[model samples]
Target: MSSSVPHAKPGGRAAAGAARAASPSIIVIGVGMKMRGDGGFGAAVIEALRAYPAVVDRVRLAACDGEPARMIDLWQGYRCALVLDAVRGGSERHGFVYRRELDPEVGDFGAQPGGTSHAVGLGAAARLAHVMDRLPGRLILYAVHGRDFRLGAPLSGPVAQAVPELAARIGREVLGALAAAAAGAGKPAKGG
Candidate 1:
């Protein structure tokens, strides 16, 4: 199954304007279900970001059901896509946030059986999209450490406490990307 995510139109003054105007744009995808304790961290980050006016109008946020296909659709057309999800990798302790280039060759992502409720695996979706020439210019995967996937309505203690730090880091990254994009466009960097 394929899906298409909507894109935001660029906004700013004409080239002749005195000041540089950066277009507000960003796509943040949080993938998880509410019942799976720490698995819901993605959604929590989205919720927190929504309350910030500075980012609310600049970023497009979506809650995905941990499905790669849906995530791909939701991220299409955005210049940058940040995927937030809970991951189970034995190398790291719970609640740790790790950022790295998504490598399809070395990870538990390959052995996972069955399509997630959303239709594909995270690694597969990204790899396929890149191979198919559909990936955004900037794609990032943020895996939040999760210890419990047990059925419940609340986040586990570790995951719950990491929300603020994660959200702040994401916000900063998004803003920095936007600024960089604007700079590359030959406009003065925003806030410079």
Candidate 2:
């Protein structure tokens, strides 16, 4: 429900690049499964971002089912990548959100649960990308705790409520990256 969504969405590659260089350099990727309960957090957040006017205009957006290769490919050229996904296998309460900026050490990810919906999880994706040198300059992950993953079930109550909240936070991060790119900030992506 933010009133500050940007009015214009940047067009395809050529147009987006010519019109705004930063738009292509920054990518936002949402990963999840819609058919399972609470597995749709990533997609839901992306949907909220799409409806918001400010976000789509300033960056590249992608939705994926947490497939490792596809995930790496989508973020290739971008300098900064903000990835959103559902997480399970942890003690965290449902609807809890964890924000972690992974380090370059591809070996140890500290057990990042990228949800049970995928065969290989997101931490594996990052490691693979690192091995192939496909990682963007900065890769930040926002993981939402999932309560259920039964196929065809709807999102849990807490997860349903968390969708918009996480979306707004991500929207702000996108705009901040846009601003930094615009002002020639040229700052390192410690937390971009």
Best-matching candidate per lDDT: 2
Per-candidate TM-score against the hidden true structure = 0.74, 0.80
Q: What range of 10 consecutive residues in model 2 has the weakest lDDT sum?
A: 1-10
Structure candidate 1, residue pairs in collision: none
Tens-digit lDDT track for model 1 on 1-192?
A: 111233334553343122212433567888887777877888888887777776777777778786666776666566777888787655667787776554434322333322232335577778777766667656777777787777785887888888888888888888777777777999766899
lDDT value for model 1: 0.68
Model 2 ranges with Cα > 4 A deviation: 1-23, 111-116, 185-192
lDDT tens digits, residue span 29-93, model 2: 87887787888888888888887787877677778878888788777767888888887768888
TM-score of 1: 0.74
lDDT of 1 at 155: 87
Task: Give candidate 1's error at residue 100 in angstroms.
Answer: 2.0
